[model samples]
Target: MTMSLVFRNEKFSPDRFTGCIAERYQFINCDFSGCDLTDTQFIHCQFYDRESEQGCNFTRATLKDASFKHCDLSMNNFRSVNALGIEISECRAQGIDFRGASFMNMITTKSWFCSAFITKTNLSYANLSKVVLEKCELWDNRWVGTNVVGAIFSGSDLSGGEFSSFDWHSADFTHCDLTRSITSDLDLRSTDLEGVKLDSDQVSILVERLGIRVEE
Candidate 1:
């Protein structure tokens, strides 16, 4: 009955106190970290504010139009979820698994993905500005229309990945491997591509690294 009370089909308000309302609470767009929401199933939920989703299992959930700005989502499992219009800025997503997940129109700025696994994840139309994906797994992922400006993707294998319709200015691909990855028609006006693993063919178009005195 209390769980049903939380899911009142309205925005989550802490002031609407119900007494130890966690699993007691449901579908109210509320913050749920450090709460008694152990082993909860949130499907098609919408978050319009900073979340407290630490140590949560959001497995197989469909989170549409969720905004997770400035939250503490450390050690959360977002496996097999379809996230759209989600903003995960300033969150601590350490070891969070996004395997087989799809992301769209997401802005994950200043987020720390320390040792997070993001295998086969779809990041279309997402903005990852100033995010630290240190020692993260991005194997075989797609990046269509994704803006990863000022991101730290070092020692990442962006092989067989795609990038399109994103602001490539001031992006860094240093000390990373992009072999066999498709990056056609990209705007490299001021992209920092030092120590990137590319072939001679891919090196031709990215003449910005050549430091030669060519005609303007």
Candidate 2:
């Protein structure tokens, strides 16, 4: 806490910030709904809106196990958010839309399971097109130009990620670890590394971008 709660243009109603613990807050144009915000934390918060591009809404929010440290949450909307087990560390969360965020937990109706931790976040240009986040932890994120056409992130760890103009053929990352990630373009001949885990200098920089010369 330690002062700094602003919450301008507020519209909260529904468990109003349940289990709260905020710090350094601002949250302009706030309109959070259905807020349960279980185990909420939220340190160094801002929730963006630098004169309009819109931010801070959290529509249909539950935020099951919220954390959100060092937050800015740029351009935030978070439609239909349930955010099961959410964490979000060192956040900037640029361009965050997270369409209909759920972080699954069905257990029936075709049994489902997903959870989020989202470490060291920047999440540049975030949209997360078809989010699933299979076995989630999501370490050291930056993900510049991130849209993730049909995101799955199967057995995810995403170790030390940056991923410069990331496309990786619109995302599924089976059994992913992506050790010390900084994949400049990740074109492993059309990308689809079965049980992905690269390291060894990122497989010699993705086999020298397919020119191949690993004579070591």
Candidate 3:
């Protein structure tokens, strides 16, 4: 069969799209909600201006510049994929894997990526607002030129991560493990650090900059 996207409408909610293939198809300004795209493959597809189907797969595929908006993507797998310039808004993306993914211009707003396992991912120039990343693992990741506004990373593990020139006023690292994480000019007011593991130097820096008391 030909690899082309079909059936895109406002009222069309496609469920059960198992084993379908749509490689490198352009889906511009389309709406897909309450759909099931389990086991479907969209290799290198371009969805620059469209909301995502409620249920979809992006597992181990190349989705550079795909925009997903106002969808429920709970228990989805974005494991080991390259999704650059992607925009996800108002969605539930619980338990997704973004290991080694590179996002040069990704933008996400009002989205929930709770308990997602992200390792060595590159988030360059990504904009996130009102997004919840609670209990997620962001180890060894790179947040270069990322602008996080009103985004929460509570109880998340950010050990040995590099955050260069990131906007910290809008980013909430509440109760997250930032042990040895590199950051500069971060204004953390509402963030909690009760049990966060930090080295001596990092602890001293936090105490001087944030005025947080360290318990011996």
* Order by TM-score, highest first: 3, 1, 2
Off by over 4 Å in 2: 1-8, 14-28, 33-48, 52-54, 57-80, 83-102, 108-122, 125-132, 135-142, 145-152, 155-162, 165-172, 175-182, 185-205, 209-211, 214-216
Give residue 43's error in model 3 in angstroms: 9.1
Candidate 2 on 39-103: residue-level lDDT in tens? 88989888886887578888778898889898889878887799988899988998888987889
Superposition error at 14 for model 1 (Å): 14
Write candidate 3's Cα lDDT for 120-177 as tens digits: 5455544444455666666776676665576677777888777777766566676677
- Write one digit per residue (lDDT tens) for candidate 1, span 1-216: 223333322433323322322222233233332232222223323222234433455555555434343333444556655554334433344445555444433347644334434444455644465555544455555576665666667766676666666565545566777776676655445566667687655666566545543353
- For each candidate in turn, the TM-score is 0.45, 0.36, 0.48
Off by over 4 Å in 3: 1-35, 38-113, 187-195, 207-216
Can you tell me which runs of candidate 1 are displaced by over 4 Å?
1-113, 187-189, 204-216
Backbone clashes for every candidate come to: 5, 0, 0
Cα RMSD (angstroms) for every candidate in the order listed = 12.4, 12.4, 11.5
Error of 3 at 168 (Å): 2.0
Q: If both were scored by lDDT, which would come out higher, candidate 1 or candidate 3? A: 3
